[model samples]
Target: MIPWIELDSAAIPGETGTLRLKRRGDEFSIMLGANELMNSRLSGSEEALAELSCAKLAGRKAPVVLIGGLGMGFTLRAALAVLPGDARVVVAELVPAVVKWARGEMAAVFKGSLDDPRVEIHTGDVASLIEKSKSAFDAILLDVDNGPDGLTRASNDRLYDAGGLGRSGRALRLGGVLAVWSSGPDPRFTARMEKAGFATEVRTVRANAKRRGAKHVIWLGVGHR
Candidate 1:
């Protein structure tokens, strides 16, 4: 068995914990403490997050999409694959190292999604971006933290709270969608989306493309017309 090689480490801005990038042969993983934040081998659910969201915006010309978090670029690449050629994708990632890893050691995993002509990378809090806009995006895809429960930063909880949901809704254009990825199901979160006036659907997806990995959850919240 090949031992995992630690590529690099970075301190999560608001948290004391450090994020480490490791690789075991072709597989790569981002770890926070002992928890695996994301793994290259398990991206089915992430891809689903993008696919389902883009599906809702089918036929919309020049759709503007915002993706929070750049984990291995799975969601970004998936979104790019399905969106119209003229669509624009803005990726907001809180950790600079994650972006660096994508361009550095994990370049192969990202497959040039970062360099795609339509992509714009923002190095800051996605929540701030959400708050700064008013009906600006056709879709906002969030894969930040583990889920609504959040593990990396305490402030991440705001991104899943009532105010956060409200801001997300306000940041989206009419008939827009907010797609979120989670490690597991959260009943409270589903209810929150409804309370925030989004027509919501929760989907259970496999972690692996082969369809035989731990189940993950994705919430698609359509903005109320």
Candidate 2:
């Protein structure tokens, strides 16, 4: 096996562990110490996430979107491609270092998402952004800390809990969408979204456009229309 080369490390705001970006040959991984948070190529959930959230309103007025997590900026880049010119993309990344890494070492992968006119990168908990806003966003995509189950930071649990989910529901306008990318299915989570009064749907997408395997799930909670 080849050794993983250390690419960079960033300290997460209000969190103990630092976000580390590493690479081994062509394979890349983002980690918080021993735990691997996300793999570059294999994580197609983000693409699906951006797609699901942006759907149904592609040509509408300036759509305001909040994306939690800045991993590789794949989701952000994808969203930019699909959204209209007037759309606004606000990315809330808990770790400032992760933002720096994305701007530096992973610059090419992110391609201009950081400097894009429609983008606003916030170095704080995404939950805070949801809590502070009131029916402000057209779509909200939660790709932070591995779904509802938080492994890297204990505080991340709040983002998937009852209060966190409720805040997300309230942050959206009527018919606004809330999309979450999980590694696998979680029945309890789907139930929670229903409890929050969202017309929910659980969708599975391929890891890559050409690959064949069990599809990756992306949960979408649509608010009242």
Candidate 3:
């Protein structure tokens, strides 16, 4: 049996808790208290987050995409796989350490996706970027907090609120997509997406690629400008 090894820990910005990085053999996990925020082995849902959202931007030439959270680059790698070479992906990661871990200890997991010419790393709040933009993105994929119920930081709740969703709508180009990944479903979040003038679809995906694990939720919304 392999034992879990703690690789590193960093405090959550503007929050009291810390995020712990651990590894057991080839598997890695980012933990916030007792909850696992992300795991290297279970990347299906995260990959689906990008696949489903990028599919919405299929014919759009040179699309600009915004990805919130840099968990393990699963979504980023997935998006890069589907998007054309001219497309741009801007990833906003709230915690700087997460980014460090990505480029450092977790580089193998990321597979150099961060170095892709089409990818940009924003070491700040995703909300700030969305709030200040107007139709600047073709797609916005959020894997921020655990499904809207947010287990890491209290500020993450704002990203799922009505006002936040409104900003996201305005940040995206007409007919652009906004995809959110969650550990579970949130009915209110779905309702809010609709109220924000988006035609929403809810999807249940497996946590791992084998399609045999805990069911996770992904909400895809196409904004109507």
TM-score per candidate? 0.98, 0.92, 0.98
- lDDT per residue (tens digit) for residues 1-225 in model 1: 999999899998888989999999999989999999999999899999999999999989899999999889999999999998899999999999899889989989998888899999999999899999998999999998888866888888889999999999999999999999999999999999999999999999999978989999999999985
- Residue-level lDDT tens digits of model 2 in 8-57: 78776666778778988877789888877777776466777897789856
Which number leads on lDDT? Answer: 1
Error of 3 at 163 (Å): 0.7
**Candidate 2 wrong stretches, greater than 4 Å:** 212-214
Could you tell me how far off, in angstroms, the CA of residue 109 lies in candidate 2 after the best superposition? 0.9
Off by over 4 Å in 1: none
Model 2 whole-model lDDT (C-alpha atoms): 0.83
TM-score: model 3 vs. ground truth: 0.98
Q: After superposition, how far is residue 75 of candidate 3 from its true place, in Å?
A: 0.4
Q: Who is ahead in TM-score, 2 or 3?
A: 3
